[model samples]
Target: MLPHERSLVKRLQSQPFALIGINSDGDADKVKKILKDQDITWRQSIEGSTRGPWPTKWNVKSWPTIYVLDAQGVIRYKNVREKAMDEAIDTLLAEMKGAKK
Candidate 1:
């Protein structure tokens, strides 16, 4: 699996989070199928054209980008390249727990 894919799986298993991946080229269906086969529930949105969430909203420049958003739909982690995601999950959980306190 891709680093981002692995990171997503880890998050889904451990947190109250949702994974949404965008494919600007309109090929997200294949990725979705693969994830489904692995029993990974992910949501995907495809842009109408090459004009992705850029300059006006999210400013994404690459394909297979991952955005980890909080409950209020605000982006907390926007790493273009995927990482291990352990620290990120800890930080997000801490923030959520702090808010609840």
Candidate 2:
């Protein structure tokens, strides 16, 4: 993720952002349901993580990673720790506000 991507993610988190999980491990269906259960809407990009567009293709290495992106399609946060969603959201929101001006 780039510096601008971080800023964009912070902005999105301040409002409403989507949690997209790109799994190349063929567990897309299972993970989709989990996110739904949490009332979080997500999309599974079946391109198998390692064979996608630039940047994503290079950085992705693990399964079940979360990427929070803004409406502009710029990644705000990637490889987010699922256990720290709350803190991440709070920090992202605050950062977004700080960078708004």
Candidate 3:
């Protein structure tokens, strides 16, 4: 997942795309290590625990919960990955281009 995420971030460098990581790790030290070891370049919010504010509010039932939001900050897709994720992003980018014109 990290590799794919890195690819997405690199590929969308010139676009209005953001990959915000909401980490639910209990230990802040471990999270920092992960960020460095994994080479995570995107922005991250460090929630204290799985029961932390972000996860609690979003009702995250799984570990790697994925959400794809549009330019207007609306959640358009959830729990999608790989090809489906790419398709959703591509469609949204195209829509963004059409909207600009």
Alpha-carbon deviation at 38 in model 1, angstroms: 7.4
For model 3 the local lDDT of residue 48 reads 75
Across residues 1-101, which tens digit of lDDT does each residue of candidate 1 receive?
Answer: 35556556665676776555554544567656655676655665655445756422666665545666676777777663445355675678688889999
**Candidate 2 residues 1-101, lDDT tens each?**
32333454555564755544454544567656655664444355555336565337557566555665544556667666634554666666667677777
- List TM-score per model, in order: 0.58, 0.44, 0.92
* Pick by lDDT: 2 or 3, better one: 3
The best-first sequence of candidates by lDDT reads 3, 1, 2
Query: lDDT score, residue 37, model 3?
Result: 95
Where's the lowest-lDDT run of ten residues in candidate 1? 47-56
Give me the overall lDDT of model 2: 0.55
For model 2, what is the alpha-carbon lDDT of residue 30? Answer: 62
Best candidate (score: TM-score): 3
Pairing residues by index, what is the TM-score of model 3?
A: 0.92
